[model samples]
Target: MGLGFGFKGRIVACAMSSLLATIAAPVWAAADIVIGQVAPLTGVIAGTGDEYVAGAHAYFAHVNAKGGVNGRKIRVVVKDDGYKPDQTLALTKEMIAQDNPVALFGFVGTANVLSLVKNKVLSDAGIALLAPYTGSLDLREPMNPNIFHIRASYTDETAKMVEHLHTIGIRKFAVMYQDDAFGKSGLAGAESALAKLGLKAVATGSYDRTKPEEVGAAIKAIEPASPEAIIMVSVNKASSAFIKQLRAAGSRAQLYSISVVNFKELLKNAGEEIVRGVGIAQVMPFPYTPATPVVREFQGLMQQYAPGKVISYASMESFVAAKVLVEALRRAGPEPTREKVLAALEAVRDYDVGGFKIGFGPNNRIGSRFVDITVIGRDGKLLK
Candidate 1:
């Protein structure tokens, strides 16, 4: 009986010790799924980048509130490269090393994106890049496998604009462009699209990308041509200065621009009367009304996640991109690696996010070609 009692005491003591140790152990929560972005959060085009990142965050926030993707919350880690190419490359490498991000999203400039491609940043890291803001053809063609473009290319946007102008019998075209890879890409597209219709730009003008106000040379070249239409392949600041000066120079040509120019900014900077009737290409759907289910959801999420923020096409594009990224993450299964996400992205075919259709494959990376045109009406509002 004594031996039995001693054995029982030993067993009880062992059990108690085990239980105490288990109770004392720290409970560690699951780590967040980190995504990274390098964009111009400061500089000339800073507003566009801020809107883009905010849109992505709004979607991610919505997803996180619903328990996130596969039980892991998504977190975006961002670094500002200030729209500089060298800084973009360096910061991207830094992000990859520090954050171990599954993918990168919403890089803002043409030169910046091209720098990433040229240096094989995405390929070397074996990561995917989603929805870079610029639409340069160089990024699209020769198909870098690591990059997945969500928005239409500059080539596509320019083709739509040129084709529309030609269809309306508006000949005698003039071209005004920013002196950079972005501007040159748009110029080439405009020229190519015009060539297909047997038309050519009667005059072409260019301004330094950094100094948008120094458009004296471009104006001198283009204004005197007396073209019926002018395709302004530049961003908001440069375009605003050019339009104001061109009008001041007594040129009455109808102005058209690529998707990069924010119409609201134009209205604010150049005034409603000066910007009235300016045609701008749009890659995303209208963000104001519930024209599509995707847009409706975007509006709700924006209000919920980021209340009182101005809704613009730039932000909407990033929002669409975030939704697509979430879908890819879902398809990648519970534990997603960079490789799995890339495969999932490639496998996406006609996947509808609410109402917008996104399709991709092994050979095709550009997700959507849905381009529309909106004009700044006399009242400083975008009109269809």
Candidate 2:
């Protein structure tokens, strides 16, 4: 069974209420800051959501241990939305109404995030929506002021992969993507990127995320296209299955993937031999690099909080999101309000956290768009 927060909330509430009564003090002062998070703690995408939540919690724990932001402790109220759009909308509404958190952070999926964005709740309420895990084009284009993205868009990752492929003289391309909004967006972006080089995908295939059997069939159909390379825009599990099937079919075309498929799970499931020579695009610095201070700190935190887990691009993105939120909270100061916090976040320009610098302006909501491409080596590691 999935863990629910209601029981924990009641216990915390009772203890806080009792402490306040005993001390004759208010439970929350005007300066108290609370951030809300809605993620799929249970369901198909739970693993992704759990990584984000864990990173956010670990960052706040560090901040709180160091006396917090301007003497105010940060409280994150997380709810499970199961990666469902309807549940995300409902739970987000509840967070705003009941918890009255200053902002929303770490929402899980593209459809779910887009659903909340469509309702205009974040803009209307002047709340910050930070570092949503999805790389959908909708989040970056025609941007909303309230949503600050720390991760690169799928468009950015796809474009980078296409550029790298072109550099390697692989002209003819094909795409295999999950048939959803994410897939369509990725397809559109890849087409546009290829157009820049006066080229386009020779073939395209898609699979429904609900059906795993269809993925292998789709790959089989696309293999006949005989393109120079195949770009996979999919999650880890589906991507692994597709690669395994493609290898089984004796397809030797170069395999390329967006960051979603560039995960430890993919490497583990598909093995080094299967993933060797595969190219993957990333939006964040490689997790194994210890030269950068931010990377070093993140490594230490991961070791202390989530040891034995191989760090991936998503984990780095989650860490960056936590840093951005902490920066906003610090700028908002002790007597922070929702409006003030949002304004503070908007004011972030060339702000450096350790070594990573992020900037957010009035015209732009996304702080970073830089991406790097890496390939899986024979040792089963992504190397630049």
Candidate 3:
């Protein structure tokens, strides 16, 4: 038998109580700064979501250890939405009513975040959401003052990938995307980028987000074109399945993915041999290389805080985003409000977080437009 309504209600109540307790406890006496995060903590994409939150927490730990911003420690109250938009909206509303987080951070999916924006939750509550994980161009359109983006858009990532492929004389293109808001957003971006170069995808494929294993339809759609390369706008599980199936079908098209796919998860799901030679457009600095000061700092902090966790692009992006948020908090003064934080974020212009540069303006919500392409090498390692 399935869980009854009463049982389900009890579960939800328990979750809400636990979330409240986490925020209320650990009294710093100076009153710790609270931030809320609603993402997929338990679902197909939970691994990536966990790493993102872990990365933000690692940075917050670093900041708190250094006395925090204005002598107040930062604490994040996290709630799991399980990659469901309705759950994201509900959890966010509950967080706002109970915990009263000054800002929302590190939300995972395009549909999940869009639910909040479309319903006027951010504007109605007047809370700023910083560094949501999705790069969909939809978020940037019309410029919601309550939401701030820290990474490059999907458009930027696709343009960079397509432009690089064009330079190498690989003109015939195809796209395989997840069939949802996130997927469609990336597909649109890829098409737009190709159109700018006087070209279009030779083929396109889309698989259901919930039924990633059922990719025969997608394969059938894209196989006939026999394009030289394919841009994949999907997360780990679906992408891995597609790669395995495509390879089994004897397709030799070079595969590329966006930054949203967790490299470690892809390696784990698809194995080193299957994921080998796949290119991915990165929105953040390479974490393993330590070529940049920020990357080195991130590596050191990950060691100190999240000892056993493997450094990854998702974590690196979150770490950098947390740093930007903290910087903005510092500028928001000792007694910070949501409006003050938003103003502080807008005031940031060409601010350097070690080596990585981020800038934002009242008219420009995007903090960075940096995109670099990388490939999977031997032993499931990324080659720059």
* Model 3 stretches astray by more than 4 angstroms: 1-28
lDDT of each: 0.89, 0.82, 0.90
* Candidate 2: C-alpha lDDT: 0.82
**Steric clash pairs (candidate 2):** none
Pick the winner on TM-score between candidates 2 and 3.
3
Q: How many residue pairs clash (N, CA or C atoms closer than 3 angstroms) in each of the candidate models, in the order given? A: 1, 0, 0
TM-score of each: 0.94, 0.89, 0.91
Global fold similarity of model 3 (TM-score)? 0.91
Position 79, candidate 2: lDDT: 97
Candidate 2 least-lDDT 10 residues: 209-218
Residue lDDT tens for model 2, 1-384 = 656558888899899999889789765564457899999888765667777787667678788778788888888899998877889999998899899898788887788888888998787777888888878988778877888887788898889889888997999999998888777888888999999999989888888866633586678668888889988888777788888988888889998888766456777778888889888888877778887888898888877767765466666777878888888888887777888888988999987767777888999887888788888886776789
Off by over 4 Å in 1: 1-28
- Give the candidate number with the greatest lDDT: 3
Pairs that collide in candidate 1 are 135-154
Native-to-model Cα distance after best TM-score fit, residue 224 in candidate 1, in Å: 0.9
Q: In candidate 3, which residue pairs get closer than 3 Å at backbone N, Cα or C atoms, i.e. clash? A: none
lDDT of each residue in 316-367, candidate 3, tens digit only: 9889989999999999998888888889988999989889999989899899
